[model samples]
Target: MENEMRSANTEPLHKPLGSSRTFPHFEGLLFSPVQLVKKSLADDVPVDIETKIGPHARRPLKLSMPIMISAMGYGVALSKSFSIALARGTAMAGTAFNTGQGPVLKEHRDNAKFMVVQYHGAFWRPTVHQLGQADMIEIRLGQGANAGAGTVVKVTDLPPDVLADFLATTHEMVDKPLKELVVPPGIPEIRTQSDLRQLIHHLRLAGHGVPIAVKLAASNYLETEMEMALRAGADVIVIDGAQAGTHGSPAILVDDFGLPTLAALCRADDYLRLNRRRDHVSLVVSGRIRTPGDMLKALALGADAVYIASAALFATAHKQVLKPLPFEPPTQIAWVNGTHASDFSIDEGADSLARFLTSSSEELKSGIRALGKRSLREVDRSDLVAWDSEVARITGLPLV
Candidate 1:
């Protein structure tokens, strides 16, 4: 009876999942600029910085900054130049980059100081040897948007090797009877969370390698899911909210089904406390972590660092406007194979990131000061005042 009841409760997740709802009808909450400033001034208190995740893991990873870039899979979200520019930005910010759900670009490995590589699908393969190179490898169960859904990448979105693999998989899967085969439009692999976990365990067992991570979309049973992930040997966990950006999938999937980042992070933090193993794993939060304040709030709530990507893409694209006349996003193909350049000669892009990181860090420190704190580690969940929802729910902010 208990098993039956649990199964009944889990069914809603099978529905076509969409953007996060931890703060339901979130769009209704945003207002004009002046109100933003006025509301920003309302908070008052000293931030309580705390170590929300395991001290051993956090110390080794050393993720101190609140904002880290969410990995948008290569091709769909960024080109080589775009990624390199983002790497430059992350370096400026003293943060890490979550490698999007694609093969780890060697250039990205060299360009970024810290990274989390996510294994997205079967066709997106990386050998254990490849896994050894990562600071951490994240096995993605589902991103918030298009949960239970996978993407179809245009040839343009895939690099040569990924393209070859996708074509081979598609061809192999195509011969099967329609009843026995199901493939997503843009992605060639059919991934289940169970499959992801199996792979995660293998990576964790690889001696001396960085820890293995698993990324999941938040659902009502998130606590259970997290516990299971921990049990499955995940050293780090990423709770990507439905509000997280995706280049593919129906618009409906983008707006419904999953929890928002704010709520998901809060729930994951709570889950850690419940299991008494919050200290055993590192918690990284992604899904619209655009600013330092977002990172600060998440860290105080329990996340170690925020993942980012979209913002850096825009930054790089805009800066590219000043590149050599008639700039097209550059490509790197190997000798006689069209290898693209990773060299970022344009100081504009790198300089922009440097300035943005410095300014944002300062702004974060100001928020800290208002709350009567010093370092980022000092900020805590209590330092925030949720004006929107009541105590029982994600607070709806008072539109200033």
Candidate 2:
């Protein structure tokens, strides 16, 4: 009877309709594996720091500082502004930066010391050629802010200069109004297991010999997915937590599906360790990693390095003076009942990000000194403690 029930449950889940335009549904919403993992664990620990992925490696990625600016993507953050901010900030504090998806602006590549270029689409220059340009190649399966939903892009996210550059490149007619910016999702054919294997091969074959990292949201059976990634040649895996913020995402998908950052880290670590590939790859955590304390906590919970995004933007924001947007009117569209917010004072937005980058970097460096660590790699689980392990246990975590 158990086998019979299991068999029944294994049937094709909400098969896609025969019609191209028609969609299918299980219960009118997307099905997620988070609901199952949430119910299975117990004894969650606040400090389960244990080196798991690529454990036997000689040295881990010695991120100068414990923090990084998680790439919010090209269209989400003004062209190259975020990267420039990181270059200055990371150089000051010492850390890595992510080259987010979307159009790869030239300026983003200019100053990046340790840039992780994300392969978002089929069109991305394969990692083989990009190895010299980036230290790490992060495979973005999904983001915590949206899980497997969509990438956020509004005209307001681009700087006037960048938009001008883009316009010239595409040769499309004229000014895009603040209210009429059409953020088109770049069409790509690179979202499959095979696609990942090819990219991994590219990274390994690159002249610079960069390590490849695959990123995923805590939306499904992560243990299962991560194992596949390891088998597919992943040198590192990034598990983005739900608390990770974004310019915008559909409320349902954003709020639903995926474990919080801490929870996902625990599961992924356990899986990698148990699989006996701990030394073969590494685990990095991301999503709202603002302070040294946050990075400290994540490391104590088994993350090799904690990635950040919003925090970096805070460092690079322009001080007070905002740049005005040239686009007269920006177009907007509603996706999944979610209205788009497009304010085109692009310069103002850039100014804020540039200023933010500076401030946040200083704050992070202070935290590192307080911890008595000269570099990010020196800070470990032993240097920190979880203040709320009991509360974590209440969430059904597997206590050590």
Candidate 3:
């Protein structure tokens, strides 16, 4: 069906949702539980699921659990109501919410406990005051779904409020409103390592010492990119793998580019360790990480935390998807341009998402206790074993 659609259209097939392709994930990896030799933590024993990103930074991003809500932009991706729900939900769960490649929505900042603002390659730049409000600043060079692809949103398509915000934040005054807003593939100011270093320095100063993160698509040149980002003084590095979700990315880019999450995480972990920089900079990995087990496995393999978008979106919508069921797709309730977007209930969505995060965190704590560990920091590669030989080879874990 997808191939038929591609054949019919001259333009690249634009998938309105995430990638349909399946990548090798953490399913082949199993956690090693303790029983006889090493005793598991008692049921009553408290487990600390707290996580700190960019620990060495003056203002590290601290969360109650090792899960964060990944970037799902307002206007471009999610509706205003959905974005605010995500903010409230993350706050309720005691985690952080990221303002994606869209205009900074004041409501998101107002409701979120911790806000990570993306410094993206878009026409509109956040004001200095907006930067100061961030818990972390993520420089989005590329993402797993689209890599360096640019986005073009027709001005007429944007909601009135979103359009106003965009015009207000634009760097220069336009005699007339732009016909469209184009977000470039790369930051115009950053052409070299030195340029990146300077930008990070400037952001650090502007953000009043908050962590400066560099988010990159997990690629074959992962190590080289990591080196450049580290040299630029990035306090945290986010490796978004091939399985990462996107609102609207071309089918070819979604299916044919980037490394899988498990491979990317292992390679990144090894690079950081070998260079003795693991302790200095935090590592956050995201891509098809849905369940608590996946999150735990990511942490064991050396990710400081995990980010979730698809999962969070589903959780937020919960049974409310019935509103757009049968006739319309479920995402129509949450997407910015969706037919039923205005019908989305912010309070209900927030509650549902918060419950999901809390439940997932509890499950992670249970897994930690089963491993005879009381804290997330105690989890390591040794706590995991691979069922597949290929998985074993990639993760350096023994095969059962």
Candidate 4:
């Protein structure tokens, strides 16, 4: 069906949704549960699932669970109401929400408990006040979906209010209104390791001692990139694998570029361990990490935490999607420029997403207890075995 649609058109087939391509993920890796060898924790026993990012920084970004809402920009990826609902939902879950490559909305700040703002390659950068309000700062080097590709937003497609907000925060002077806004492939200011270090340092000062994170697309050069980020004094490293989703991107980049989440995590873990910096820097992995089991597998494979986007979006809409069913796509109610976006209920979306996070967190605790572990940090590669020989070789786990 997708191929037919592609063949029908000459222009690149753009999905208004995430990448549909499947990648080798954690499905082959199974948890080695304890029973006779090691007594499992009783159902009544407590488990600690709390996570801290950038523990070595002046102030770490703390979460009640190891799950976070990945960057979904407002006014570009999601409607204002949807963005605020995400903020409220993450706050309810006692987790963190990230502001993607869009202008920061004050409503998000007001509702969010912990907000991580992305310093993107766009001309409209976050202001000092916005940076100061962030719980953490993520330097967007690249993402899983588009890799280093830039973004183009047609002015006519955006809501008037959103367009106004973007123009207001733009760093460059515009004598006339722009027909389209273009986000460059990479930060124009950063061309070398020294440039990155300076930017991180400046962001640290602007963020008022908040943890500084460097987000990168998973690639073959993962170690070299990690080294550069480490030298730049990054407190946290976020790896978004090829399996990650996006609002929209070229099919070529989505299907062919970047490494799979499983491979990226292993390589990143090995690099950090080899340099003895694993304990000093926090590592967060994201790319098709939907279920609690996937989250557990990622943590076991050496990720300190995981991020979720499509799952969170679906959870937010949940049954509300039925409202647009049989007539228009569900995204019509959630997208920033969605036709039915105004009809989206913020309260309901927030409640649904909060419940999803809470439920996922509880399931994680159950998995931990089944492994005879009481803490998330206790589950490591030792607790995992690969069902596939190739997976075992990649993860260095015993093949079952």
Candidate 5:
């Protein structure tokens, strides 16, 4: 009877629909290795992993590694300790940490050697004075997890200190009751192309030559989006694909929206090359880029750099994840207001995360040597081949 019931209750997970299983992602594509004839003499010599974002800027954002800590905000998604730890860890790795749609905190800024501040639809928009503090400013247009949607967090779930900080930074509490904090779908002020251009101009002046980046979810019309961003005077374009993670988002949106990371990268790269804007605007890709191989592949496909959030969070929670055990998700340890949030040690987190970054970067350099390349710029489409026909067609790469 138990076996019969179990059989009856079983459901199709990979393909719940008639033919489609949500949207396709990076699982279908892979990097084809070349190990026969051409090989690097610098296998023993150190490879140059250093990267620059927004090369056209008077001063570009330089990173020791091509991988950067992606946005996971304080109060909104992560605890203050976790945020600071992430910042310090990336600083140790000589990369940047992004403040994801959260209010900029002094603790994060102090710890982060390079900071990417996200100007989101949330009420906590940074003031002109605060904008000047950022190494890079990202105008978040949409996210992979919830492409055209917004999120709401209740004030009741917030701690007193966090609530106080939020109130101090934003105008929501002054205008409305603190029952719930709402983030609108898009920046209400940015309605048209002219508005976008004007906002970018103002942000450029406020940031004092810091790179102004535009972050967008990977969509079918991504080429148009890239053109629009460039026209609006964006220095960098960040694309987060469907496989990207978020603290909380509707299941439908997460599963059904946006293009896969690989498709987005190839399409965007092709568009940039065609228009001769590839060098003028920096391209940064993210979403499910967990391994060093994925990072290297992205760079080869035309991404100047890659962003990592979920992987870094997992690295930070290396040992502490066990504290939650079978009862709760490991993420609870780093989550704000989580039961195990207090158990997360900032020192341990930073150390583990920095170590992970170092090891991953080493692995990337080794891969570059295998490809017979001295630097990242030398590693391009010729260094890569597709595993299957679909991938080959989409990427315009030779099939293995």
Candidate 6:
């Protein structure tokens, strides 16, 4: 009788699956808005969003604004055209563009004013000359999506020329579809803190005085990790939170790994302050930072700057995505080897992205002024108050 009653409560096997449950995201938290006195009375006065990263270094990296284009590799994640367009757009906006693990394209390097080259764990590491060309070097320890897991890509999926290049660089060949594939994972040499220190020393020399940054996924021991990175001589620390997106990461890794952006940012900040290195090493945060309000909130919470990837891609694709729509996801237009990849216009995409950055900076400046602050640096944690109890606790900010 109990079994019969339980069976009656179960849904039919033939019923279609419902929408997947929503995951916790940065959007769940709300930022306290500026409501009282204005910071700038002169509407003509432009807010100085210019920020200097790695100030203690011989050659510090500077930006016109606090926002930058995050790492998104060419061939692996996006096409050459998309990479070039983003580089051009970021250059126009006076911001930096990061070249992810994939081999760097000359077009992107030529177009971007400030290029941050990523040294990944993959076999596709760049040559010393290539590394020297970058304005900044980021040693990628891990990412928010698929933190420690390896990622595989089939050779057949790549174009003929791209496949040949990858083969030559990695000295790898495909015997069969499933048996042989391109896989990238954590750097084998960096199993200990001592190894990380050696890598930082090598990169510092290879980068030709350019700032060397260490990128790590936000996890429970992020503070401890940051300490090691700083001790290893990293000029900047990039914390990628759970809300961060990836082009082709596994669903399980994306959904289940890393700490949220709020928690990660607060913990890193607290650690830096405790060590009296708050002003020594710059902290850059990346996750699901969508709106200008989100960027402002992150900056106020102690982030020196913000790294934007998915948002930049969307801005670059802009109206171009419409061309591929009704048939595929918008990213299909941006992805390498996508059916519509060739259809994307670099000129149009670059223009759209530049406008997006400019407008977003303006909005952020408005928010800064609303808080009675003249500069982005003036907008600190004191100006912020969280509406959600969980967010308040996670960020260590006051509750509204």
Best by lDDT: 4
Q: What is the per-residue lDDT of model 6 for residues 255-324, given as tens digits with 9 covering 90 to 100?
A: 6678877788888998999989998999999988878988988898899999998888899999999988
What alpha-carbon RMSD in Å does predicted model 5 have with respect to the real structure? 4.5
The 0-to-1 C-alpha lDDT of every candidate, in the order given, reads 0.57, 0.53, 0.90, 0.91, 0.83, 0.80
What's the TM-score of every candidate structure?
0.70, 0.63, 0.98, 0.98, 0.92, 0.90
If the candidates were sorted by their lDDT against the true structure, best first, what order would they fall in?
A: 4, 3, 5, 6, 1, 2
Query: What TM-score does candidate 4 reach?
Result: 0.98
Q: Which stretches of candidate 4 lie over 4 Å from their true place?
A: 3-10
1 or 2, which is superior by lDDT? Answer: 1
With candidate 1 superimposed using the best TM-score fit, by how many Å does residue 236's alpha carbon deviate from the native?
A: 1.6
lDDT of 3: 0.90
Model 1 scores worst on lDDT over the 10 consecutive residues at: 329-338
In model 6, the runs with Cα more than 4 Å from the true position are 1-40, 167-183
Task: Indicate the residue-level lDDT of 169 in model 2.
Answer: 35
Tell me which residue pairs clash in candidate 5: none
Q: Candidate 6: worst 10 consecutive residues by lDDT?
A: 12-21
Candidate 4 per-residue lDDT, tens place, 1-400, comes to: 7689899998776664457776667988899878899988988899999999999888899999999999999877899999999999999999999999888988989999999999987878799899999999999889898898787788898989989888888677888868988878868889999999999999999998889999999999899999999999999999999989888888878888999989999999999999999999999999999999999999999999999999999999998898888799888788889878998999999999999999999999999999998999899889998998878888888988
lDDT tens digits by residue: candidate 1, 57-123: 3224554355666665554444455556566666766666666654456767777776666665544
Reference-based lDDT, residue 313, model 5: 89
Per-residue lDDT of 146-231 in model 2, one digit per residue for the tens? 67655534556455655554344332445445432333232245556686677677665662556677788875578888877887
